[model samples]
Target: MEALDFAAESLDAIWSEGAIYNIGFERGVSEWRRFIKPDGILAVSELTWLTERRPADLDTHWREHYVEVDTASAKLALLERQGYAPLGYFVLPRRCWLDGYYRPLQQRFAAFLQAHGNSPAAEAIVEERRHEIELYERYGQYFGYGFYIARKCHYG
Candidate 1:
């Protein structure tokens, strides 16, 4: 894999939206912290549990897929442990998931299938996304993307 290279404490802010899962939440913040100046900002939109309790299926699916999926309170505490001061946080609204994201993605499925020649693999990908949307429709109240805004502490 390629690497991230930056001078230590050079950045005034780091912002990541719906993409930090590639490195995992804790690892993303920890690894990137050294690249941010003291008092620099770190803003990220991360998958988060909206409620403390979840159905077995929901919990199992997330833990198996993204181990760091956690409640917003726990995520905030994690920021504290990572040398950042929690500035603000909120879960993206349900409409953000349905109207803004999944709907738009669904709209592209037919063209994607056409471009891919309607291969089994392409169909499977579409099915997977459909399944994901169904799960959200059923269990939306339990989890969502939590947008977190923080500032690197003056002293770690």
Candidate 2:
């Protein structure tokens, strides 16, 4: 995938997995326009700030690493300008079962972090995982990652 020069031409569709939060919705939409076919779709899962009110304890680690994001309305507007419109939006809340999903390798991840603690990259990994766990355990709400299915519009 690294060898492909996608920007040189448009793609049939762009699946933006776990990227909207990383790049923020605006940039992600712009990037999709640059590489996606005019009639294609852009699908993404992202943490949306639906309201302007900021959470008092926004995860520090996440904020530092991922740019602070905006509401779905703001994102919709941005996407519209890029010739795309939202088709659907949905959310999947965190549950105790999710912990089971990670339990198998939780210890392994911890051990890896311990062994690589002194490195910058390791620190980032540790901080992110720790904050996710904390949010799930204490607030019963991990990241509210949202999915937006958008399709490029045609203009005469």
Candidate 3:
């Protein structure tokens, strides 16, 4: 069965961390809103611009990779438009990336590279991950993951 086969308004809460970006933030919110009970909550974490004026290089990189990335206010506006009442939101700390994700990934990538030294595909994948980490190190101050918490409006 497809994903939507689940009954509507059957869930008390819906939480989507990093995965929502895969479906596009606006679309994800719009689609998932139907699955929640009127008073249910939706908590999502998405990439957001932290500063009003971003450096050109960082802006260019995200525009190329994730064109939909926007400021937290913009995301809140979208939530409001989609019938969600904002409760609270916070920017994830840098440690969430460096400590929780990238560092462990770097260790794994190093092991994978050693095990597959002969594979060009493996090298390319490692290189891409390295580049992402490097970009985060340099431009982390301008943007980050934002956790948004909201309650579904009764009318929606």
- Write down the lDDT of every candidate, Cα atoms only: 0.93, 0.65, 0.90
Per-residue CA lDDT of model 3 for 11-106, tens digit only, reads 899998888888889998899998999989999999999988988988888888888899999999999999999999999999999999999999
List model 2 lDDT by residue over 1-156, tens digit each.
223367633687878766555556676677657677667888887766544554467655456656645556766777788789779777645543255534544666767877886588987776777666665456444345667788887668
TM-score, structure 3 vs. true: 0.92
Candidate 2 lDDT for residue 83? 82
Off by over 4 Å in 3: 114-118
TM-score of each: 0.93, 0.71, 0.92
Winner by lDDT: 1
Candidate no. 2 TM-score: 0.71
lDDT of 1 by residue, 1-156 (tens): 026888999999999999999989999999989999999999999999999998999899889888999999999999999999999999999999999999999999999999999999999999989888988999999999999999999753
Output the lDDT of residue 10, model 2.
Answer: 69
- The 10 consecutive residues of candidate 3 with the worst lDDT sum are 1-10
Per model, state how many residue pairs clash: 0, 0, 0
Better of 1 and 2 by TM-score: 1
